[model samples]
Target: MSLFNGTIQALEHSLGYSSAKNRAISSNLANLDTPNYKAKDVTFKNYLAHEFSRPIQAKTTNSRHIGFQGDTQPAGYKTIINQASSYQHNGNNVDVDKEMADLAENQIYYQALVDRISGKFGSLQTALKGGR
Candidate 1:
């Protein structure tokens, strides 16, 4: 068992996930008019898996499950592509409004994660300094 806990790890993964989503949204926005450009998306599950090394939907069937420390939820993250079927005249599937909304949401999520991680570190630092 570690001294800190899983909270920091979880927050770090969330930050990474949000950053990835931001990048994906930026890419979609940049290639809005590009022909046949399918918008790529990173699901929340994907980063959850990357963070915890567990599949997001994996159920405990047998005894040899990963991270089977009595935890029930499995873990994994899957990247979805080609979600947009009906494209515009240029065959682009990027939805500007949707992508913008996702971008803003992701930014908020990232900031929250950062703040939590910062607080956790601050607490640890204070502890190290003899609670001064």
Candidate 2:
């Protein structure tokens, strides 16, 4: 059995998802003034659904063994570009207020995951130290 019982793995995935969303939001904000730039969005529910659909029991015992491909990083998260028309005459679709809100929301989510992972490690360290 794994030491974390998959808690760490789930948390890792969550962190990656939050990070990806943050990057997308950042990118949108960064291009807020660039003409013809479209805004991008990353949805957590889609990421989780994609992650859950993968087989969890499969394992590769050797380099030659067949293993699951992809899903290695936040890149696995779906990023949807806003294709609709923009309010700005320059055709930039990014909304400053929305991107700022998303950034704040993602920061909170990312911090919570980091705290959880830190606590998980702390408990492991305590266990390793005989409850000291």
Candidate 3:
């Protein structure tokens, strides 16, 4: 189980990040017409860097050695609720073009991550079935 712990953790992190990002984007879209609404974004890279900076414990051959415990939710993935420059007369700062582009890109990345995780599981399944 320790052998695949890193991969599993990475997949989980990716899924969580994507889900949070999607939620933030959806919220922004919903508030598009709200006065003085600013779009929020998830800081995924910062989270990854922070997580990577932490020292990881390696499993030992000793019977008493405990396995490494990864973070359930890493820090630095904070939502930035910065105010956007208002261009419209209604004081709304939502940029439809940028939002749409971001949404599409995020969706594509999420799908790719899902596919990769699925492939990993498929490989595990194949190995478990004696490589049939």
Candidate 4:
């Protein structure tokens, strides 16, 4: 009877990742003119893979095992440093075009995830109301 099922959890995680990516892109854009400011990025592929691969196990020694912990949601996004391809005259490494593109893409992804979560909740609501 968990309101946040696996799909919901995954979508939430993706939303978090998108949020982090958006923040990173914003930071990079903000420091585009700052001297010696290297662009940073958040890696989500590895985290998504790890989340998918990890099994949700309950702490139990007998038949009366507790599933509360196992029912908890997965971890959120993580930020990491990104190596810049080139450095500018002022020692800044942020590429404006790249950062803009990343921001746009991340925004799209975030919106899609939000839509999916909304749809899921809508369906749950419909089910609860007996399809009324």
Model 2, 1-132: lDDT tens digits are 576867898898888788889889989887889999999998666666666776665566778988756544332567788888696899998889988988998899899999999999999999999999
- Candidate 4 lDDT over residue span 1-132, tens digit each: 445546786776687788778888888888888887878988877766667767775446577765544343455557776655556888788888888888888888888888888899899899999999
Q: TM-score of each candidate?
A: 0.75, 0.78, 0.79, 0.76
Cα shift from native, residue 121, model 3 (Å): 0.6
Best by lDDT: 2
- In candidate 2, list every pair of residues with a backbone clash: none
**Could you tell which candidate, 3 or 4, scores higher by lDDT?**
3
Instruction: Put the candidates in lDDT order, highest first.
Output: 2, 3, 4, 1
Q: Which stretches of candidate 2 lie over 4 Å from their true place?
A: 50-76
Per-residue C-alpha lDDT of model 1 across residues 35-125, encoded as one tens digit per residue? 8898989888544444476434444667787643444432434457875484688778888999989988888888888888888889999
- When summed lDDT is taken over every stretch of 10 residues in candidate 1, the lowest stretch is 68-77
Clashes of 4: 1
Residue 106 Cα positional deviation in candidate 4, in Å, after optimal superposition: 0.6
Look at candidate 4 and give me any clashing residue pairs: 36-91
